[model samples]
Target: MATIKDIAKQAGVSISTVSYALNGSPKVTPETTERILAIAKELNYIPNAAARSLKTRETKIIGIFLTDFSGAFYGDLLQGTKETLTRKGYELIVCSGKQSHWMLPERMIDGAIILDVTFDSEDLIRYADRGHKLVVLDRELAHPNINQVLLDNKAGATLATEYLIEEGHREIYAVTGPGSSYDSKQRLQAVMQVVERTAGVQLHVIEGDFNKEGGELAAKAIMAGRRDGQAAAAVFCFNDEMAIGMMNYIAEHHSDIQVGEHIHIIGFDNMELASYSQPRLSTIDYSKRKWGALAAEQLVKLINSDAVENERIYVTLLKGKSVGTSK
Candidate 1:
């Protein structure tokens, strides 16, 4: 690896001059700084992490922690966050460390962004416990030290349930995701509220793990043993994956079940693939990317600002075309 010594020799300046110029010190003249930078770039000189860390006490980089990155969820989130932060001269780091209960970067850097933490709040809590300046997206939490940003899970679910109710479908079947997720738990609770207000209406509930396989099995379970008048006309899945799985089963054996004809289907996330599906699954569309950006902005402002306290960020609801009927 090329070193500062190499650049200094090439730029024909003293080592001290090179250091001052490259590190953006005020003592260095603008003309010298430009010349040193040009020489360093020409040589493809990469600064030592430790040396750079000592100088800036900041990497101007954000660490991103998330479970799954395959679907629209993490992709959209990264895009939104990168657009905002990088434009402001910050870089991002993505680490898929789902195996560990918590994460401690091998090297220290500035700040963090956590997404869909999946019940392992311990790592974050511990980080915040140490007064780490960080932001969280999607998990509804707050602390004196850490800033939080999350979706209005109850509101979104309530809106979806209300839409289903208005579709003239009284008997509804609900497929819930694995019981662990904050979003899943809140969403199921919201559906329960709808069931309570509308008397004699039953919403069948099943457990899924927020994946396609879970959805397939849940639907098969429902279809195999559905009692007379108990099987719902439409099933509301916890997310697009489960909905798609349910759709797959419906297509394979129950080919007669047409979306909006025999049974209606709805999903969450409004993932890109959701629209391309056979009937084009209807889902809730919210900006995970915006969610990511908001979370980062709040945390950075809180930590960097001289303000003594941090504030909270709220979420919005998005409506999509999964519901096929009208009241």
Candidate 2:
């Protein structure tokens, strides 16, 4: 309700003098600034955020975009991003859905870290063309304004598949994530490559959406293919969420088909729940927190017009009771 005009009129000063005093400009005397501040407090004056942003040309805020908030996957990642950004004098805002995409183009955030598969590569390129700095976690895009901090999906998948093969699994089931997913495609390609090279090995590909329901459905298919209490078969679920889903389904419905016994299983992501399962889930391990932290760091560098190199989070294979040697 209070404007600079009102403060100037009450203080018996010009509007420009009021503006300078309110902004803490050294041009205005300390006495004038203190008087103007007291009047602003009495009037409950609030500075305009839009005007401040325009003058500074920076908001000191970074946005992290995710495809959707689900499972235990995003917690550590977001924590890493927030801690890194906060330490660097910036704030982090988590966003999702189509509406949040506008935040980048509209210049509401200083920079962005993207892991949302729903975001098109062309759109990201367009944003780069407009000089918006970005760091991508789920896909590859080469541009000076854009950097990548992606997982080593191919190596993780290879480790998962090779571990099963070393355990003498010939008939392996490979549950895949969404077709459009870059990680899925990379992981599946690696799995197929290993399978082709291993003589007498067969890989049955099952389509999945990287969700629990997809894992449950894949479980049903696997169960149908083999009889109860027969020779054990190995299954490689694309992600830990799906692997846990399959384990749950088998435990509830098929008592005879034990996870580590009749149906050996392996998964990727090494999620927290993997260790707590009845037979600890064998999985591909990587540092999700570091993945997020690096992305934030890269985005900040890009925003500052500093040189930034693309980054990759490495992976390892963690053996567990969920995987057993085939008879």
Measured by lDDT, the strongest candidate is 2
Residue ranges of candidate 2 with Cα displaced over 4 Å: 2-43
My TM-score estimates for the predictions, one after another, are 0.86, 0.90
lDDT of 2 at 103: 92
Model 1 stretches with alpha carbons more than 4 Å out? 6-14, 42-44, 98-107, 116-119, 227-232, 306-327
Weakest 10 consecutive residues, lDDT, candidate 2?
318-327
Best by TM-score: 2
Candidate 2 residue 48 Cα shift, in angstroms, is: 2.1
How far residue 309's Cα lies from its native spot in candidate 2, in Å, is: 0.5
**lDDT by residue for model 2 (1-327), tens:** 888788888889998898888777999999989999999888888877677678788888899999999878999999889989999999999999988999998888999998999899999999999999999999999989999998999999999999899888889999999998999999999999999999989889999989999999999998888965556799999999999999999998899777887888899999999999889999999988898888988888888888878889999999998445664
